[model samples]
Target: MLNKKKELYVAVAVGLIALGGAAVFASQSSSGDNAAKDKKPPASLTSVTISDQQATHIEVVPVKTYDFVEQNEAVGYIDFNQDATVQVFTPYQGRIRQVFVKAGDDVRKGQALFSVDSPDLVTAESTLISTAGLTKLTTAALERAKKMLETQTAAQKDVDQATADQQTADANFRAARDAVRIFGKSDADIDRLLQTRKVDGELTVNSPLTGKVTARNAAPGLLTQPGNAPAPVTVSDLSTVWMVASVSETDLPRMKMGQSVSVAVMAYPGKIFQGKVNNIGIAIDPATHRVGVRSEIKDPEHLLHPQMLATYRIRVADPVQSAAAPLNALVREGDGTMTAYVTKDGRTFTRRAVQTGLEQEGNRQILSGLQPGEKIAADGAIFLSNMLSLQSR
Candidate 1:
């Protein structure tokens, strides 16, 4: 019985040994499979050899030169063209009797913008009326004295004294008339005032030019002084506007007067405002490390407003000759580098990294990693990159 029990224990131990070996073998097999799955091809394997059938799908062309002009971009704001703007202020001190126009109102040359009840005009008119009455009375007295002298009823000295009085009155009336004219009274207006013995004290201030009003601080009964702050009205010719750009100081040397600029604004999407650099700031801003570049943009429609956000691009340099690759010949890699599929034998293509510059037309300016006359995949480069990535993985 003891021998049988020992044999039974030996059989159980052998079965347990076999089970342990099988488990170990299975574990090793699983680890080998995982390692094979995780293995990646060498990164140096960037070249791909394809059959003629595959080569037919890719459009390969020789690299050529392109004319590229460097441009500087900047953000800025829209503003009024100060050269065409004017502040309309009353020339004389008076309480505003009437404001004929408000902000945003269009005005023409010689159009009355406002009227002032001027006390100076009133005083001038009063003097003119008194002088006119005195002249009429003195002339009648002189005529009576001349008639009486002819009849010997008055002495020659009396006649001479009346003539002198009449002459003095005439001179005074002429001076008063001149004074009223200075107050903007026309000849006809003065004549009518003389006939009616009435005065029009309100003075009309006319616009100096054709423009649209930009601001209005004038109201009825508002006291205004000459050339004061917060001008009663501001007008500007809307045929043009200003685009002010803050350009980096490093780019200041590139900016020049009369350089053409293309501007865009958020308010008008897809519309370009064409302008030219009219002024450049003499001093750089210490806070922003930038300089102000002002451009005058034609705005015939008067659509641009002050303080609108805008952006602009100014071509600083002339066009330069450089190698250009077809736009589709390059592909952006996952590592953020640009890669082009280069080929010497036409069927065997290799990935070449390149540095690019301005993209104009359908070509990209190749600054480095490429040469003119080299064969590159002009199209279907993205396909090659995808195939290469899949095979490498």
Candidate 2:
């Protein structure tokens, strides 16, 4: 009975091992079948058939070699023409008496922008008064010495010394007058001040250009000096604006001065601002390796503002020979490959992978994998791609 039991146990162990092997084989076969079902067709083999009604909606165009201008794209911002932007600073140190203009106020050249009560002006007036007094005294002394010399009561040396003193006094008087003039006072005003001996100690600031006041920092009783931050006022002439863009090193050769440029800002969609290249920087940025290009755009309506984000398109090529298709016909696949659908017959569209170059003005350049005379699906390329994706599944 013990021998028979050992033989039966060995037989059961062998049966169990066979069953496990069969199970693994069956699982692998099932996985292989699934993988076959999931495999996708090659791009060229993918095709789609649409009804006549669907065909009516699709646009078709022939790939052709075009002699058209190539456009290069860059991003940049709008800036005030620095040549027309001015920061106003007062030459005299003083306390602000009044502000005549506010931000955004249109001002003319020589218009008063603000007024200040400056002790510096008072000091200048006092100096002028003292110098005039000394001048008068010296003149009288010189006359007395001349008369004495003529009558032989004083020596010629005394008359000569007195003449020198008068000359020195005259120079001091003129310098004092100039010191007041530097504060924007007129000669007539200085003459009146000397006669009246009354000083106003008030200085008014004027605009240097005909522009809109962009900033104001003055207030009553606030002390101000030259070179202060947030300058007393800022004036900007907005008749013209600058659009600055960054061009990559690779695209630098295509850029040239006086080339026409089109600028678009988010604030105004569908509107293209016209401009021309004014300058291109020779130095490349160490951090970005990009060169700067500046375009001068006329803003007659003052619609553009400083620091506004803008898009720039510059025409680099002039009627160059190249192969291209309408931008609508290009499709981007899931594998990051660019493709376009071509057709030998109207009913069947074959997808072709293409290497692409620059895209501009509603057209894209095909570097390879496309012929000049081939017909492509221009409007419904995306729809065909979507249908092919569904059929593969």
Candidate 3:
């Protein structure tokens, strides 16, 4: 019975050893499978190739490092520099007797714009003439009184009264003359009115500065007055104009006074207007959350007109250091990854995913996934991508 029991125990120990060996083998097999699944495929294994004869048709260049500006684009419009614009009004109530200029006319300073028949001018001129006559009469009387006193034929009281009258007449004459001058009449015209004794009620309105007439309300026989509806005319100096732009809240941080800007107008395509930021608004619009930005552009050629649609690009940052690639070298893949083809030898070109930065002019900035000296397809990268796609299919 003792020998049979020992035999059973030996059989059970052998079975347990076999089971342990089998479990170790299965665990080793599973770990090997997982490592194979996690391994990434080599890019050279799937790289695209072309013959030397085909390579002559395509151009390749080394990736370059340079400084690039990050640009922010905004829509804007050409506007008048309010400081250089003027809305002219007549100085007195009157009827427009004649119109000498029209809208769109270039006018010089002191150029006659229109003439008005003013009753106020008539009243002022009449007072001036009366005062001139009275002053002349008082002066003659004063001279006679002085001569009589010198010969001891008149009392001192008589001379003193005459001198007082003369002084009073002079004060009245100056007041009347100034009133006529206030009605847009020059001092010389006032003198002529007094000298010729002519009562001229015609008042002429003149341009206050050199500019182009942008609006006109003057017409023959129209009743007009100072501060009436629509000024007599609007003149604007277009030598330097304002470009008003609304900047998004996201881009407001990029704007500052004196920042350089480039403007393009639909009126003259291909012509770029240069300007600088003159002002930035303190208030942000509630609805759009955009701040107002005003840039002053020199339009000495008068090529830009007010209210014209314009596009603005602002350079907000100093040029940044980055790897630059030709725009033609970049290819956007179906997976939305930006890629470029790189090659160590001319025959085998591998696909490399590159992170892109600012794209301006024709140059694109490569933020990552490319070295400075790596060779890339400069002109025909898209064609290579297409060929690779066909082969994969």
Candidate 2 structure, TM-score to reference: 0.63
lDDT of 2 by residue, 293-316 (tens): 999988888899999999989988
lDDT values for all models: 0.90, 0.90, 0.90
Q: Compared with the true structure, what per-residue lDDT tens digits does model 1 show for residues 1-393?
A: 999999999999999999999999999999999999999766756988878888888899999999987889999999989999988877677889999998889999878888888888888999999999999999999999999999999999999999999999999999999998876678999999999988878887778889999998989898888898899888889899999989999999899999989888888887888999999999989999999999999999877899999999998988899999988899999999999989998888899999999986578999999999999987789888988888787
Task: For model 1, state the Cα shift of residue 337 in Å.
Answer: 3.9
Residue 47, model 3: lDDT of 69
Q: What order do you get sorting by TM-score, best first? A: 3, 1, 2
**On a 0 to 1 TM-score scale, where does candidate 3 land against the true structure?**
0.75
Worst 10 residues of 3 by lDDT: 39-48
Clashes of 1: 0
Backbone clash total, candidate 3:
0
Clashing pairs in 2: none
The candidate 2 region of ten consecutive residues with least summed lDDT is: 40-49
Kindly report the root-mean-square deviation of model 3 from the true structure over all alpha carbons: 9.8
Candidate 1 has what TM-score?
A: 0.65
